[model samples]
Target: MTKTWLIYALGGGWGHITRALSLGRIAAKHSKVRILTNSPYAHYLNAEGCLVQWIPDSAGFSATCQQVRHIILNAECDRLIIDTFPRGLGGELADILPQLQHIPRILIHRDINPRYIAAKNLRSFVAENFDAVIVPGEGKDLPFCDLPNVHHTAPWLIRSDVDLPERTLTRSHILKVNETIKTILVCCAGQAEELPLFAEIALKLHQEFPKCAVRILAADCPPNCQDLWISHHPGIECLAVADVVVGGAGYNTVYECAALRVPLVAIALKRLYDRQDKRAQAYCYWVQDIQSAIDTVKMLVDRIEPQKKPLPSYINGAVQAVHHIMSYKF
Candidate 1:
């Protein structure tokens, strides 16, 4: 009988869903893989050929828990992979924890902020419940670093050619573009709350360097900044060929830029869970002030070559994670 795996990617953002898809693709080769998520990115999950069960975000905690429990019990999965939140976002997994106690539970624990350091109860719950923990990519100085069951692997990236075929094609088209027209890619976070700041920077950069092309990848464009907006998902090709990339220090974007060896100017955004500020400081050319971030992008655009470099071993995190999962005794 084929092994069956149920991946619980409970969260709001694209990060959790993307990570789950990356691992799910690998696991599908050896097992029947299905994803349970509440993310709006469920369509992307379906597109990747995984069976996705969408949990309504507006559903009450108890209702959500019942839905998840029903699915898991019915599937009779051999293994369970929980992404990010150990207790499930909004504690929806609490009800199913006991039911899954007999099976192997793997937690894809990402880096956390200082606030989580005081979450003693949450940490203790994870320690007691999870069979193994996988930390993706340069997750040094994490709260769970000392945990005996925790395993560190390369940064979890969703870069499979099968997952992002459009990006692969875009990359080829971008590579053929003339080098004389300099390109700068600005990726505001998914929320795009900082659209005004990005607009101001884009205007300044356009004025300062008239020959350069400024492309902003955002959900919405601010007033009078329509020319800069490039509404597209997974703008990896634009990032790959850009003279410089200015963006928030979100995990997926930062690691993607790094893997493509694009020159980056990462502005630390305050997030509740992931310490993007710390990650930016450690990995990229980080700046606290918006003005400094713009200045850094300008400097890199002038100095650095717009050529791709081979990703380091640490950035190949998804592969490492798959190997570890497949080899685990449980």
Candidate 2:
């Protein structure tokens, strides 16, 4: 019999959507997959061959709850995979847990911060509800590390099909440019509010290092902040060729840089739940001020070597996660 999987990947930003896409693509090979999300990236999921149901951002609390309930009760998927938030984005899943208790459910609990640890009800809710919790990558100093049913795998990363030869070609092209011109890739997260800050940093870097060419990987740019912007470019390709990569301390970006062995300078952003500030400290260089970031980039641009180290063992989380999900008996 063909197994059916219903994946709930609700949250803001592209991280949730990308993770879902990575796992969903793999799961589709063995089982039918449908993604339930409210992210704008839902269209990308659809294009990538997963069945997607877009929950509008403007959806009210009752409507969101009803939609989730309807899908769980009617979709009849053999199992459920809930990503990130266990209580749903707006606590919509709380009302449907009783109906789903009999079904086999897997929760992808990425990481928990101090705020989450302080939420007594949230922790208790997850403990009582989920059959298994999969923590992608290395375990942090999180409160939920000791959960009996929790499983840890390699860092969950979106695998790229771009091969070594292609990456080499891209790198060669970048290096062929004038030796005096230094190329910097500014990779911001998919949040509009963060773009202006990055733009300012880019301008400062350009002003201080006049010989350096700073390019931003963004669809749109702020009015006052100006720099060469490439609206659409493959992230891995950009990372491979650039002299340095400056980005927010999101899990996906950090892991991508690590996997590619790029010289990374991370700027910790203020996220309500995800502890980017804490995560940034583990990387090569982390800065809060624009001036500090500029200085760090300048220091590392010439000294940093292209990552030649073998990919870390923890990066195989996608495959390991699929294996666990497929092997579990409902």
Candidate 3:
């Protein structure tokens, strides 16, 4: 009999859906997977053999609650895996998880705002309802690590090294100067409002490194950006060729950079749940402003070589996450 796994990935931005797809892709090999989300990029991220239940951002709390509650009662959902915000982005799932106690409920417990945890009293509620709580990133920073059945894993990224698209740079660009071509890839996949900020960095970097090719990789191409490569997810192929990667210090970007051993000059953005400041400090080259980002990029470029020395690869959380999720036999 084929099992069906339901994953709640309603968090804003591309991170949750991408991470959800990573797990769903693996789960789809044996079991059917349904990922419920509200990402604008859902159309581009729909995985084969897995269903994407797209919810709109305009859908208010009551409607979202109705939809999520109905899915929980869905007889086809053999297991439920929630990606952060256990109670939904705005408490939509507060009363939903408990209603489905018979089904095995798993939580992808990435770090969140400490104040929200206290306000929601999630510690007790999660401890009682969730059968398993997996932290996709480092669990050290999270306050509620003591929760029952909590497992620590690495960051879950959309694509792995082996899965990354082969070199996308042009032959002229690659063979330019008969040596390493200066390629700067700026990834801005989170909030669309921050596109200007990321674009500013891209422009400044272009101005600073006029001869080098500075490409902007975002959901939508920024205005006046000379070279723009648009994509719904992080630019994995571009990251492989980037001399210096620039982006916000979100979970996916930071770890993906580290995994590929590509140098990153990440600007830490303040988030309600994710502590990007801390992540920026720990994993990559941290910078405060556009100017600092440019300076760091320059420093990184100066030391960068055409051929990178092999370094140990970071653990891929999707593999480990699938292992844990699949272990709960139907």
Maximum-lDDT candidate: 3
Name the weakest run of 10 consecutive residues (lDDT summed) in model 3. 170-179
RMSD of 2: 3.4
Candidate 2, residues 113-138: lDDT per residue as tens digits? Answer: 66765774767787888888888874
Query: Which RMSD does model 3 reach against the true structure?
Result: 2.7
Best by TM-score: 3
Q: What are the clashing pairs of model 3?
A: none
Winner of 1 and 3 under lDDT: 3
Better of 1 and 2 by TM-score: 2
Tens-digit lDDT track of model 1 for 1-330 = 888888988776666777787777677777888889877555534435567778876776788878877786676778888887777776667666767777889888888765764663667788878888898875666777778988898776666433444433454454333555667877765454567877777777777767777777665666467877765555554675576888878888888788776767887777778788877877789987767877787787777664443322334677788888777886
- TM accuracy, model 1: 0.85
**Model 1, residue 182: displacement in angstroms?**
2.2
Candidate 1 ranges beyond 4 A from true positions: 44-46, 56-66, 160-177, 192-200, 219-226, 308-315
Name every residue pair that clashes in candidate 1. 137-154, 137-155, 154-317
